[model samples]
Structure formats: structure tokens, C-alpha cells
Target: MPYFRPIALALCAFALAVPVAAQEVNVYSYREPALIQPLMDGFTEQTGIAVNVAFLNKGMIERLRAEGRRSPADLVFTTDISRLHSVVSAGLTQPVTEAKLTDNIPAAYRDPGNHWFGLTVRARVIYASKARVKKGGVTSYEDLADPKWQGRICTRSGTHSYMLALTAAYLHHHGEANTLNWLKAVKANLARKPQGNDRAQVKAIWAGECDISLGNTYYMGQMLADPEQQDWASSVSIEFPVFEGAGTHVNVSGMAMTKFAPNRAEALALMAYLAAPAAQEVYASDNYEYPIAPGTQADPLVQSWGSFEADPVNLSTIAELRSEALLLTELADFDG
Candidate 1:
């Protein structure tokens, strides 16, 4: 069964009573409601367009395929390049050639065909224990495999999307043979069997179970906001590890227009609004992510974590390498 949780917008209550020609947009989002509610509310307040979001934990593509031309989804909101690429590859999204979109988002962050646009960027970084790991103890992704850190790393399942994305980026920098060996070496260094979410890994560090873990940048903000997790968050410092000759590996939270959008005009308005500088600021400030719009600044808290050059390879290339990355992960029995 598809897990659908509709966000309760003020407009949603009267949506059924509104005329057929009313201005509105429907979004099928893989992101949680709390993460995007402010953006939806901002768009509605600015344009007077009713925004209805259906949060789907999984199976968004299958649900859209099942609905076919009858699907009411105007936009698809998600994180990670692979999920965005999957929607485009499934033939479920249409090309958006709006100049506002093109001008605001950099080419490296958007689909070459205009099928999707990245709103924010997050680097896959090391969360190193402040007490156990010295400053500059880890400076590169290749260092994770070094024997000196044996049984000192904590990570999520090898096949999880975040891990695979990192693995995929590794494959791009080094070919299959080297990537496989790197994976095996990293796996051998795990503190325990690959387990839990990124936050859990940080918690493990606080519990003195591991010295470092791999996670996204935004997670620190999330942890700091939660009273119980603050200590877990405080125990580690964010480390931007480079990919040998390349920069830090990064991914995005992005948006796309559905191929069968019933509210094309309204959807376009929201898309443009999101890419606008002001909206980008809101997203950055509220989510602790790096805004992708040109000249847009990230939240001060995010900036304080410092920055690094994002990997120069286009995300589409990373998406293409995901399949092979997963195959290597499984073959190595990384979880075992």
C-alpha cells in the first residue's frame, strides 16, 4: 500500500468546495511535511494559489504510474539525485524551459533536459568524535579505508540511498576495481554491523561506540534543535572530506513538474517562487542547507560549519553510476 499523508493547509479544507477553475497545485512529495510546510505556505500566501501536498514515504513513481493521465500531481518534491533521476527516467516528468529557473539554478545542479531543479545542496561528510578523533584526523574519503581507523567507523546500511550515492561518487572517481576494494576496506572498519539512520550513528559516537560516521550536513541542525539529541550532536564535529582529486561529494533536494500536471500554470509559479532568491533564503535558513540559487547565502549556522568545493561531476553522471555502485556494495556483503 502507498503511504500517503496529506498536509493540512488552510486551503485544503475548502478545496472540495472551490470551483473547477480555481487556482491550485497538487504536490506528491517524498520529503516529510514538516520540512516543506513553510515553503508551501509561503507560496500560497504570495500567489493565493491553494497548495495541497501529499507526503509519500515511498512508491511515488508507482502511484503516479497507476494513476496515469488521471494523476492530479502538478509537482514532485524529493531529496537525492537518484530519486529525481528515477522519476525522469520513468517518463513521469516533463521538460521545464522557464528562464527564471534556468537563470536562478546553476547548470550543474539542474537536469540538462530541464526535467528537475535542485533547491538545496548537502555534502556527505564525516561526523567525527570531538574527544576521540583529532582535528585533521580525516581529510579525504580515501582515509576511511586506512587501517589506522579499524573498527572506528559507524555507518548506515551499505545499500541505503545515501551510502550508495557516496559509493557511486567513489566509483566515478576510481573505477570498479578500486571502488570494490575501498568498499571492502570501509566495511571491515565498521564499529558494528551496518545499522541505524545517520542520527543513530552520531548517537553511537556519543555513547563511545565509534569514532566517526558518515552523514549529511543538515543532520547537525536537526540534532541541535532536538533537546535529547543535542548531546549526541555536540559530541561530533562536521568534517568535509574530499574525494582524492575531486571535491566533496554532494547531493540535492530537488523538484520537478509532472508530465500530466493538471495545474501547469500554478505549478510553474511555485517552481519559480522556490528558485527565487527570497525563497531560497527561507529554505536555507529553515533547513540548514546550502541554497543553489546564484548569489543566495546559506543560513549563518550552516555557514559556520565551513564549506568546501562540491564535486564537479554532474549529478546525472552520479545517478547513472548508482546501479553499479549497488552491485558492488552487495557483492562485498557490506552489511554482513
Candidate 2:
């Protein structure tokens, strides 16, 4: 009880001396909030900068353009190389010249012009029916077009951004003529019309509607986690096919600074934080994707799938060819 009043006053004074955190960074994200909130919480816990996110499933670029110069957005985060390139091409995003970002992310996953940075990578892989297809039946991207697999394959619409990006990567290594012919070949092999999402293709395989399908690696992780889709996830095994001499096709979930970033410094700090191993660990694990940072281990489930050599080509090159790829898909009447 001795000096109790003075001790209480001193504790109150210490509490009053602590600074309040007033800084915030606004984010416009195509990524779902539940998927990214943990990273945001971790960032705020470390730096005391609040992150405000607006989630958009579509029309992300259009929304930014409509907002124009006075836009409150400081950062844009989304999936696919195409979306990243689209924002830059529209001039809605500004270049980030941070050395910390460049040092943490690999050269292939980022914009050479520094306009965007990839946070995590997802590989385009083959899902083969374990009961029907032999282990070595499919070894390369070219095999999807082989006559032996005709009437045994399933896919989503050819024009979907995921497919378009894969088509673009195919165009990159194999050239237009081969790619076009390959597209037609794959179209001929479809067990049914391209419909639904990547997961639906796996469901088709489980129903014995198809023997093989093309999908992103994360979809397998997602399907496994879903109680309704566990059978579909168990029906197939993943095959890491390469592009002949090249490695597997990979796409990224990436970020960019908006052209009208009101909180540029905080945005950049967040971007750099995302690139570091600490944040990459949280972000990639949350999404079941491969970390862009070279040595960071993927989640145990993703790791159990084994690893393969990722194509050495920079993603910007694939983004450049997406339009041409989509045109070829239409010309081939791939879904028809």
C-alpha cells in the first residue's frame, strides 16, 4: 500500500505518453478480403498503418479509370499477368522503383519497367484421372493435342483469362502457326464443351466424363479443402508438364501502385513488405500458391505435389501475347 497513489499516477502517465497510429494505406484489390486480411493485419501490427481494401471481382481497371486523378487508391492487387499488364497499359498505375522489392522478387515475375510486382505464382498443370490414365501418359503441353487423347480431355472456356494466359505462353515458345494448330487439336479432344470453372473440369473427371483436364495447381488445394468437392480432388493426380525444352507455365498474383496513389510512401512500404519472406509466407500459404521469393517453401499440401522447373521466360512476354492468343482461340472456335 506504500506510495500506491504515486505508482498509479506514473502508470497513467506512461499510458498517455504512447503515440496513436493515424497513418493508413488504401488498397483496391481483385483478391477476396478473407484471403488477404491476415497479411493486412500482420502489416498493421508491425507498422501501425491501417489497410483499407475494396474488393472487386471484375472491371478493376475500368473502375480505376473512372475514379481518375482524385482516386483515393494507393495500391492495386490481383491475379494473373494479364490484369497486371492491363492496368499498366491503361496508364492507371505508376512505376515502383524500390530496390527492396526488386531484390526480394525474382526478375521473371516482375515488370522490367517496375510498374508491377508479383506476390505469388500458380502453375498451370494437368489433372489426370488416376484410375484411367497411366503415370507417363501426359508429359508435355503438346500431348493435350495428341490423337490418342481425343474425346478424353476437358477444359473451361478457351477465352477465360487463365486459358488465354496459357495459350499466350504456348504462343511464346511454339509460335502462332503451331499454337493455332495445337488449339484446334485440343478443341477436337474435348470430352464436352468447355464450360464451368477449372474445378468443374475436375468434377467432370470424377464422373468419368473425361480422362484428363487442364487446371491451376491451387484449384486442387481448394477442392481438397471443400467437403463437397473432396471426391473430385481425390479422383485425379497432378502432372507437371513442360514446354518441350522450356519448363512449366506459371502465372502470378501481383500488385501495382495506382497512378493517383494518395499514400505513396505507405503503399510502397506495403509493397516491399509483401515482397519480403515474412509477408510472402503468409500471402502464398493463404492462397495455396508458390511463393515468388526463391527459397520460401510452399504450404505442405502444395509441397507434397512435388516441384518442377518453372519456365524461364519473363511473364511480361506472355502478357504481351495474350491478345494474339485470344484471337487464335476465337478463330479456332475452340469452345464450339
Candidate 3:
């Protein structure tokens, strides 16, 4: 069994001493508590419903399954469409048709079945060397495979969720054959064998080992905030590359209600609160992710990066294609 480090919100501690049933909601989150502490704190402050979180580094689904109806979790928070979809597909989540959720999150960012709702969005963008690459040099996703970029690209493993999501989107747009060819071409263009996290690729760019890398947009904000990595971040510029006819590829950090939520009403309230404008603002300003709620703007720093239309394909569709994307990545020996 995987162990989860429990995190009790400071404001909720008073509930522990109360004799009567406590007004609280339990969360099983793959996301670090610090990243979401502000939103959770706000929810508790507004509703007086205590928030208790179990931070799980891995095995969220397995833990839920093992606990079954006895699971103390009311909600599950995670990033990536694949993970959110996996929970719903595993029968661990229930449909949430709250108008507050449906109205705030764009349809493309939510589950068609109402099983999950995205709180924030981040693009899979190109991090290009400011000195080495010309503006407008990298125009689209297809451009990455051009012979001109051979030995000039750096990226994490193709099997990583972020990469797979992009590949799955490619599959949606161009079908398997073209996606496989693109994968092979991009692999052939690697400066080194696929390695490291998205930020590591940026560090490689700063080292002059590569000219550009594929990475999520939030990583730029994360890098800039770190004193040591600021130089790596400064060496690169974020570019929103589009698909041939559509828009830039994106993924999300989202939430879902557990099937057997003990505090169903409170959980629903938290879910609605998370989707509302106030919580959306916290996601944007604090975590550096783009808020999903309509009319919410990203942090000023995030806004300075410029914007592009997010790919219109429903994220659930991309999630459904993740297996094929992974298979294609393996067949192409993308990490080799």
C-alpha cells in the first residue's frame, strides 16, 4: 500500500477538538498542498468547512480502490486529462452537473460526462533560445520535425504525460501514420536521447546543448521564480506553436468528486467554489496556471508571454487516445 502524507489546513485544526460531526471535506491530491493551499484556505474561510488533504506522490487510484466505500476522500485533485479521465474510467468518480462548474469551465476543458472539471489550463509550448532562434522561426508543431531543426531540439521522454497528450492531439489532427512519422522525425532531431523534466530541457538550452525544447507554459513562471534557474529561463522565449489548422495544444489541472463522498454536500460546495472566479484567480496568480473560469485573466507575468487560441478538441478525446499515443511512442523508440 502506498502511504499518503496527510496535510491538515491550519484554519481547519479547530474542527479536530469539536465533539459533534465536523464540517469538513477530505481530499486525495496528486498536486502538492502548497500549490493549492490558498484556494483550500479560502474555501474553508468562506464556508467554515475544514479541508484535510492527503498528498499522494503516486498510487492515488490504487489507494482509493483499496479504501473503497470506506475511503475518507471527498475529492481528488490532479493535473493532466489522462489522470482525471483515468479516475472517472475506473469508476471512482461521480457525475457533477453543478451549473457553477459547467458555466465556469469551458466545454473543451471538461469531461463530456461531467465527471471532472478543469480549474486551470497550461499550454504545451516551445521554449526557444532567444539568441539562437529567430522570431517566427518555429511556426507550428509540424515545423519541429523539419530537417532544419535536426540536432537542435531537446525534450523530455515522449512517454511522459505532457508529451503523450501532445502526441494524442497530433493523432486527433493527423491520424496515426502521420503522428508516428512526426514522432520519429522529432526523435531523430533530438540533441541527446530524451531525458529529464521540462525544466531540464530549458537548462540544456541555456548550456547551448540545444536551441529549443517542448515544455509547459507554467514551467516558465516556475523557473523565473527560482533564483538559480532565472538565467535558464531568461535564455529562452516562450512560443505558442499551433497545429496545422487548429490552435496551441494544452493540458489542465482539475478536480473531481469521489464516488462515495462522505461529505457530499460540502464536497459539492468546494467544487463549486473552486470553479468560481475567486478561486480561479488564486490558481492564476499563485500557481502560474491560466484560469479556466470565463472572464478570469492569467497573472500579469503569464500575460506578458502573449496568448494563442487553445486547441478546440475536447480534452476527454485526447485522454482517450493516450494509450495509442504511448504505444506509438514506444514503437518509435522515442526515448532511445
Candidate 4:
């Protein structure tokens, strides 16, 4: 009897020492941690669901495929439509047909098949020198390829996803031959070889190395916030260039549920919450991005840039054309 009693007590102690797993959702993210932490904290506080994040700068799809069913990720978060499309194409994300997502996110911003949803949007705009380039000087994207602007433009590599997306949009508007010509013209106009990120182009404008460049709208906010970079930002103003008929090109930061999400219900809940006004507000104010949720306002700084018509071309159409866009860039040898 005494020996039996000791065994029972030991079992009780062991059970007490090993705590039960709490409700939580694991996230695989390409966005930086500091940018996502506040949203995660808000979700945790509101729903009592612990959120774990893994920030990956590259190879997100490969990592998920390698993990397979054992992947601990409940959701995948990424910037740029290119990456979101890659995740969907890789078959790693499950279709989510939640009304909250569908209702809040616009049709153009979410997958038609419900595979992913965009959280925020940013326009790929031109940055013209405030002093050197006159206001209304650049009204359309095609204007950048004009002979007058040759030897006065700066830009990042054409092979970059950002550039490819723009090229893809151009292809949709102007056909292959015209887009190729446009690409070659833009490349020929470069003050120097396409090198450096968007901000670096603005730095060149400040340095008088170039009078104009291409950059994203959100980066303008980032530059204005930095005292050292404010001069570069101040030297230029954003131009919402259109495709003759279509409006300005824009991209998104978005999310999706993993096909093997262990916490699907929690993941769905998180996804819905992110699409809600509260989370959209956090994304807008903190990230300086245009919220996708209808009626959700842009950050004050973003709003100050004034509104322009967004290109009405469906994002799926753009995604479908990305590969061809890359091929054209290579053919034009834009970077070379």
C-alpha cells in the first residue's frame, strides 16, 4: 500500500510540473519584427491568444516546403504582391472564405479564390527634384522614357520585384513591344547604371547626381522621419504617374493561412482581426501605408501626398504577367 501511494504522488507531481499548452498562433513573416510586434501584441491582448513570429528575409517558401506538415506556422505575412503570389503558387497557403476578410478587403486586393488578403497598399511613384523638375513636369510614367529626361534619371535595378511589377503593369497597358521599348528608353535615360534601392535614388537627387528617380510612397514617410535623410526627401516630391489610360501602379503587404495550420480557428480569427478597422488603423498609422479596408484612412503623412486614381487592372492579372515582365527586363538588358 505504501509503495503504491508513492507512485501515485509522483504521477501527480509530474502532471502538475508539465503545464498545458495555451491557445496561440505561430506566424512566419517577411516583415521586420518591430513593425509587426504592435499588431501581435494587440491581438494577444484582445483575444488572449499568444502570437509567435519568425522573421525571414528570404527563402520563405522553401522553408515552409521543407517543414511540410510539421511547419509550425499558422499564418504567413509578407510585403509585395509578388511574394504573396509566390506563396499561393507554392500551394503552401489554404483558402480562407471568411466574410470578415471578404467584406473588409477590396476585391482587387485579395485573391479571387480566397487564398490571400492584402492588408495595406503603397503606390510605386516617381520622385522628381523639387527644384530641378517643375511641378506637373511628370504627369505619366511614359514621360520618364522621353529623350528630354535622358541622362537625368536615377533608379534601382530593373530586375527588382518592384521594378518588375511596374513593368508588368506597363505591359498590361502597352503590349510587349511598347513595354520593351519603354524599358529600353528608361534604361537609356539612367544617369548611371541601375544600382541601389529606392531611397538611394533620392539621395542621388539631393547630391545633384540626378534630377529625378523612382521610389515608393511609404519610403517618403520613412525619409521624412529620419533627420539625416530629410534633406533628400525635401529635395523631391512624389509624382503619381499613370499609364496614359490606367491610373498609378500600387502594391500591397498581405497575409495568408498555412495549409496545415494547427491553429486554424485562431489563425482565421487573427486574419479577421487584422482586416478589421482597428488593426487597419495600426497598420496605417505605424507603417504609413494606405489601408485596404474600405473607409479606412491613410496615415496623416500619406494623406498629405493627396489622392490619385489607382490602376484599375486586377492584381491577379499583374501577378500572371510578372514572369513575362522579368523575361522582358532580361531581354532589354536593362540592368546590363
Candidate 5:
């Protein structure tokens, strides 16, 4: 992950010159433009308010923190619970006042101060080599730690935010010692040095470089849907493991309002709109994430993975445990 910088910028000349009350929203997002543009269009179409966006590759919380109150961003639409946690910890973001967000999003997936709210969920799932692993052989997150699976794993570095969120979840349920040991066991089983994103893991399995790897539910969706990745998708099988006594490891793409938002009401409206059923569904269908709002259902591709019990642990707890998770990751000794 890298930090984004503030390159002193002025708003549109007309926007800056216009009197207040024109109703506009400016969002800085890590989510891909194609995935969110439709929703932005919908918001503009329905509200008749213009929306400005800036697309980023994966990391901006740290950058926003550096920008401080000078940041022009009204809202930060991001993925990764750990990243959202970082933003809240820095006090660069604030809570939304809209009751709709509170009513629509669950407490577990949001911040206590309402500083951030999850828009969608992506499960940390297993993608097994269909030729090597049987359909019913693996069905839980705990299975990855078993001795029998030694030397069969392929994954990204544990230091990556993706795995840290999972490590945080394990710590939440099994405690540090047990989760630490499990991570060590998993480290010992690696077929190669950890490297690449979730999609690369699936590709590794396809190449017979490894039999299984950790994957995000959405990557599986794009792999299956994209003509270029269809071959990779075909070589693997998707699994949702409930982790023995704990819930499945899951993460999210979330939103938070900037502390110094120039348009506070517009920011709150954008956050509330994202939590609404229509926007939630758009996130689900477009990003293949499980909608954070209760009545919002997942996309068809996500539904095919089969349901499992999700870790009931509140994400704030995971945020609180980030340091511990980082330490455990270092202890695991991953580099790839």
C-alpha cells in the first residue's frame, strides 16, 4: 500500500464561485470507477446534485491523515476494514447524522461513534484446486491450519491488510496464542513464498504451483465473469468455511465522512445514500460484496459460494487489535 498526496487543487471555478446551497457531493474513493460510477450517476439523476470523484488504487487513509483538515475530500469511500479503522483512529473522519445509515447498517460492521459504515462485505474464502481437493473435503477456515494440509498453501503476505483483518478476526475468537499458532502452522504449509493479490492465488492453483489459496469473494466473481480470467476461475473451486466454532472471516468496503468536509450535509447525504437499499444493492451487484444493510442481498455470484456463519465480532474490535495483528504477522515471517 502507498500514500496519496495533496497536490494543492482548487475546486471547479464555477463550484467555488457559486453561493452555498447548490447541493453538491465530492467523493474520494478507492473503489474502481466503473463499479461506482453508476451509483454516482443515479445519485445525480435523482437528487439533481453534481458529484465529483477521484479514483485511487487501494490506499489513501494515510494520505488523508497527512492532508489533515486541508483535505478537500468530503467523503472517503473505501474498502478494507483495517484501513477504515486507521482513518477513525487518526480522527480525520467523523460520524454521519442520518438515521437511515444507522438503521440500515449493523453495529458489527460500523464504527461506534458512527465515524465509518460498511457498504459491502467480502468473505476471506478458500479457492481449492478442483483436481486435487474434493468438494466436501474442506469446509471450514480451521481446516487450513491442520497438519495434513502442510506444504499445500499459497497466499499473499500475512502483512497485507487483507490477511491482517482475518488475523484480527481469529484473535477475536480464539485469542492471540491459538491464532498465532494457527498462523504459524499456515506459514509452514506454504508451497512458495507468499506473493500476489487474491486473483494471483487462484492463478497459482491453476498452474499447479499450489493447491489452495486465500481469496476474496469479489475476485472470484470477476475471474468467473471476465473472459480473460475465466480459465483461472474454472481451475479452482470456491469454499466458504465457517471456522469450526467461529464465524467466517469477512471484510468490507466502507465509507467515512471527513472531519473538515466543506459540505457536511452533502457528505452525510452521500453516506446515507450509500447505506440505502438501492446503493447497497448496486455495490453488491457491481462489486460482488455482501451488502452491509440488513434487507440488502448479495449478488448472484456471491450467493453461489454457499452461506456460512460470519464472525459476529464487531469490526471495531478488529480495528482495535491491528497492532497485535501486525505483530503476529511479523512473527509468521512472510515475504513474497
Candidate 6:
């Protein structure tokens, strides 16, 4: 998607967003509790639209299915475009016709038919021990397959959405064969069976269990920002190993409107506001996420770590590659 014009906090029409009546809207979200509350609070303040939320660990599709057209949900807030597209694929979400949303979000970041839209982005990158790994040693993602690093690499399970997303990116950039081969090679190099979340990977590094691991860019930024996590987070530096300088692989945290949303107007309104510069800035500053909106800058922590090229593949493609990635994972026999 190309850049968006600077979001003007001006008179914009949200015919679809105005309240159908005076009741609050309900939302079901898959994003972490801490990440979504800020936006929810903001929307409530601006519109007096009380929001009832169901924060879930999983099973949103099932919940929506059970709730059916009777579901009180007005919006579905989640991280990752793949997850958002999955909702679209399930026929649980409908396309939004809000002019503000159409004008704010980009085509690549949002559905071509407007089923879902990206809120923020994250880069899939390597973070290495400051004491053990050299600044320039681990430069590109492809290098994870190197034999010299055997029994030294740390990662999450292959089945995880994070690694699978990376796998899909590989398939897009290289071919399917190349991506599978890369997965197998990297799988063989595991220090321990891939088994932890991103933060756990950092702990593993600190405990001397591993030298390097995959992580999202924002996690490192968050760790460094907090004093408690600073020691470990600062000890491992974020790296961009550019393959032929093509840039690093990136991902998104996105959202979509529910198909039978009771508050479709409010849902659409909140979405438009989320893509605006103000909301974009909040995401960048508070969560270390990259704002998908054009001209919106990343947080200082991310900036201080330095910048690298990000994969431009729209997230829907990432969803398409997920099944293929899972197949590669099974063939590789990765335990985690």
C-alpha cells in the first residue's frame, strides 16, 4: 500500500458510525488486554459509546458462530492480519463502507473489499546477546540455517502463528521449496525444542540457554523501556540481517468489523479513529508498534535501535501461506 495523507482531525462523515440508538456497543477481542484498553477508553470518551468487551484467549470464531446474528459484538479487535483475514474467511466479518476508514487505511494493509484493516505493524527480527553475538554477525534471517549455529539457535514452535508467518514470508520471497528447505535447515539447528513465547526467548538468552532467538521488534522496545526488563532487554540488541539488503520481514496487528455487528456504526468509527495519526502515535509510543498509517513514526525506542527495510507483503498473503507453512513444519519434524 502507498502512503496515506496526514490524518486531518477535521469534519469527516461517518454516516455508518453514528449511533443507531443510545446504547453501548459490545466488542470481542483477541488482542492482549493491556493493548486494547487504551483505544477502547479513548473511543468511549469521545463518543460516550459505552463498550462491553469479552477478552478471550481463543475461540473467537466459535464464539461468533454460537452467538450468530444474535451476537452482541459490534467489532472484532485482534492482532495480526492473518487472524483478521481468517475471520473474513469464516464469514464472521463484513466489509466496512465508512469513508473515513477507506480514506485512512491503505489497500495492501486493508482488504481490497474492506473486510478488515491493519492497525499497527511489527517486524519479525533477530535479537542477540550483546556479550556473545557480534553486532554484524547475525545479519539476515536466512543465516539462521547455518550449521555453525547448530545447537545455538532458540525459537518458538513451528506451529505458532509467529514462526509460521515468517515461514510464509520466506515462501513469498523465495519459492515454496526454498522456504521449506530453509525451515528444515533452521529446524535442525535448534538449541532446545522450540517451546517459548517471545519473552521466554529473552529469558532463555539471559539464563545462558541460547545465544540468539526470533522476536518482534516491539517486544524488545517494551523490555528496554521498563526497568525490570531493562537488564535483559538491553543486553540483547535488535538486529536486521538484510538478505541482499532486501529488508527485514514485517507483520501487523489489525482489526475487522463483525458481520452481524449490532453497532456497525460505532465499530466503523472506532476503526477510522484507530488509523488516524493520533491513535497511530499512541500505538507507536505506548506499545512500540509501527503505525501502519503513512508518515506516522515508530517509537523512539525502535528508532534508537536503528531502522531496517521491512517486508512489504500485505498480511492476507501471510494467511494464505499459513497452511503450506504448517505442512513444511510437519515435514521438517520440528518438535516445538
lDDT of each: 0.93, 0.93, 0.93, 0.92, 0.83, 0.80
TM-score of every candidate relative to the true structure: 0.93, 0.93, 0.94, 0.94, 0.90, 0.88
Better of 4 and 5 by TM-score: 4
For residues 1-336, write the lDDT of model 4, one tens digit per residue: 987998999999999999988999999999998998999999999999999999999999999999999999999999999999999999999999989999999999999899989998999998999999998788899998999998999999998999999999999999999999999999889999999999999999999999989888999999999999999999998888888987999999999999899999999999999999778878867878899787888877799987888998878779889999999999999999
Q: How good is model 1 by TM-score? A: 0.93
TM for candidate 4 is: 0.94
- List, residue by residue over 95-155, the lDDT tens digit for candidate 1: 9999999999999899999999998899999999999999778999999999998999999
Model 5 deviation from native, Cα RMSD in Å: 8.7
| Models, CA RMSD each | 8.8, 7.0, 8.5, 2.8, 8.7, 10.4
lDDT of 3 by residue, 119-232 (tens): 999999999999999877787999999999999999999999999999999999999999999999999899999999999999999999999999999999999999999999
Candidate 1 collision pairs: none
Superposed Cα deviation of residue 50, candidate 1 (Å) = 1.3
Which ranges of candidate 2 are over 4 A from the true structure? Answer: 1-21
User: What CA RMSD would candidate 6 show?
Assistant: 10.4
Candidate 4 error regions (>4 Å):
1-19
lDDT of 2 by residue, 35-90 (tens): 99999999999999999999988988888888898798999998889999999999
Candidate 5 residue pairs in backbone clash = 151-189
lDDT of 6 by residue, 1-336 (tens): 123332332223454457567767787888776777787789889988777778987899999999899999888888776688788999999887877776666676788778888877778888798889988778888899989888888888888888888887787788878887888899888889988789788878888888899988888877876788878896788887654446678777777888898877777777778889788778656778877677778877668878876666666887888888888888878764
Cα deviation of 19 in candidate 3 (Å)?
3.8
